[model samples]
Target: MDYHIYLAGEIHSDWRDQLRASLKEKPGVHFHFYGPQENHDLSDAIGEHVLGEQPNAVYKDLQASKINNLRTELHLKKADLVIALFGEKFKQWNTATDAATAIALGKPTIVIRPESLHHPLKELSEKANVTVDTIEQAAQVIDYIFA
Candidate 1:
C-alpha cells in the first residue's frame, strides 16, 4: 500500500530537503510538502509586489488563498499521517496549523520539538497522538504508525 506522509515545518533552512531525502529511502512512502517559497516565477514576482504593496493582502488575492487552501485540503485528505518538526529556531504558525489540521481530520500526527519545549505547541502536543524530541524518534513513531 502507498503511504502518504504530510510534512509541516519551517522553510528558512534545508530541513525539509534533508527530511525528504531520508524519508525517500524508506519503502512505500510518499512525502508531500508545501512551502513559503513555492511561487518564484513571474506571477509570483507580481504577487510578491502586490503583497509588498498591501500589508493586509496576505495571499496576494483570493485566488492564491483558494489555491493554497485547496492544496492543503487535498494533501490532508491523502495523508495517512502528518509529521511536524519544530527546530531550534521556534515553531511557526503554518506548521502548527498543519499539525492541527491533521488532528482535526483524525489522522495520526507527530510533532517534533527539539530545543524549545515550552511554546504554543505544548498545548497542542497534549492532544496529538505523539510528541517527539528528535527526527529519529519521529521516524520510529512513523514506523509504528504505519506498521
Candidate 2:
C-alpha cells in the first residue's frame, strides 16, 4: 500500500516530525509525506530569491504568499490526504485554507485543533473527514483508515 500525505499547518512546532515518528513503517506499506518548506527563513526568502526584491516588506510578503500558494496548490493536488493543524501560538488562516483546498480536491482531510479552538474551527471540522486534538490521535486515525 502507498500513501501520500500532505502535512498542512502551522510550522511553529515539531508536530510534523512527531507524527512522522509515530507512524512506524508497516511491511509492504509505504508513506510519502510532503509539506511546505520547514525552514522559516528559506520559506520567507524564497520569493526574493526567485523573483527579486519587492518594493517593501508588505510587498515581500505578497511575493512570498504567491509562491507559497503555488506550492500549496500543487501539493494539495498530489496529496492522498491532508492533516491540517491549527495551533495556539498564532492565527493560522492558511491552515484552514489548506484543509478547504484538500476538501475541494476530494482528498480526505484530518484536522487538529484543541478543544479551546473547537468552536472557532467547528465549520472546518464539519467539512473534514476527521478532527483530533493531538497528533497521536491523528496517527491512530491514519493507521485505522489505511491499515
Candidate 3:
C-alpha cells in the first residue's frame, strides 16, 4: 500500500527545497507537510506540485494542535506513515511538538539533522527509526522504507 508521509522541517531553510524535490521524485508516496506556512511557503509551491498531478495522493497543512487529529483521521481513513525532518534547533515549539507527536504515534519517523550540528534531540532522537545528516541520506531511508 502507498504510504502517507508527513514532512516536518524548517520552512525558510533550503531543507524545504530538498525535501520537496525528494518527495517529487518518489511518485507513489503521499505526504502531509506540517510547518510554519508564513515562512515555509510550502503550500504555494511544493505542496501544490505534489497534489496537482496526483489525484490519489493527499497533503494536509496543519497547526500543532491539529496534527494528532489529522493523523488519526487520516490513518483511520487510509494507511499512513510519518517522515519527520528533525532540523537543527529545538527552539521552535511546533517543530519539537510535531516530532514528539510523530514519535508518540509510533509512526516510521526519520530524523534529519545537518552533519555540522550535533543531534539536538535529547531523548527523541533515540525513538526515531533512522537518523541521517543530509536530505539525500533521508531520501535513501525513505526509499528503503517504502520500497
Ranking by lDDT: 2, 1, 3
lDDT of each: 0.68, 0.90, 0.58
* Candidate 3 residue spans exceeding 4 A from truth: 23-79, 88-90
Clashes of each: 0, 0, 0
Model 3 clash number: 0
Q: What ranges in model 2 sit over 4 Å off? A: none
Tens digits of per-residue lDDT, candidate 1, 112-138, equal 886567465678898788898878777
> Which pairs of residues collide in model 2?
none
- RMSD for each model, in Å, please? 4.2, 1.1, 9.8
Q: Candidate 1: lDDT of 142?
A: 61
Model 1 Cα displacement at 111 (Å)? 0.5
Pairs that collide in candidate 3 are: none
Q: Between the candidate structures 1 and 3, which one is better when assessed by lDDT? A: 1
* Per-residue lDDT over 14-110 for candidate 3, one digit per residue giving the tens place of the 0 to 100 score: 6766766874345665555543453444443444444443333343432322444454345423325454565555455555666677677666777
Q: Could you tell me the TM-score of candidate 1?
A: 0.71
Model 3's alpha-carbon lDDT is: 0.58
Candidate 1 minimal-lDDT segment of 10 residues:
35-44
TM-score of each: 0.71, 0.95, 0.59
lDDT of 3 at 111: 73
Lowest-lDDT window of 10 residues in candidate 3? 56-65
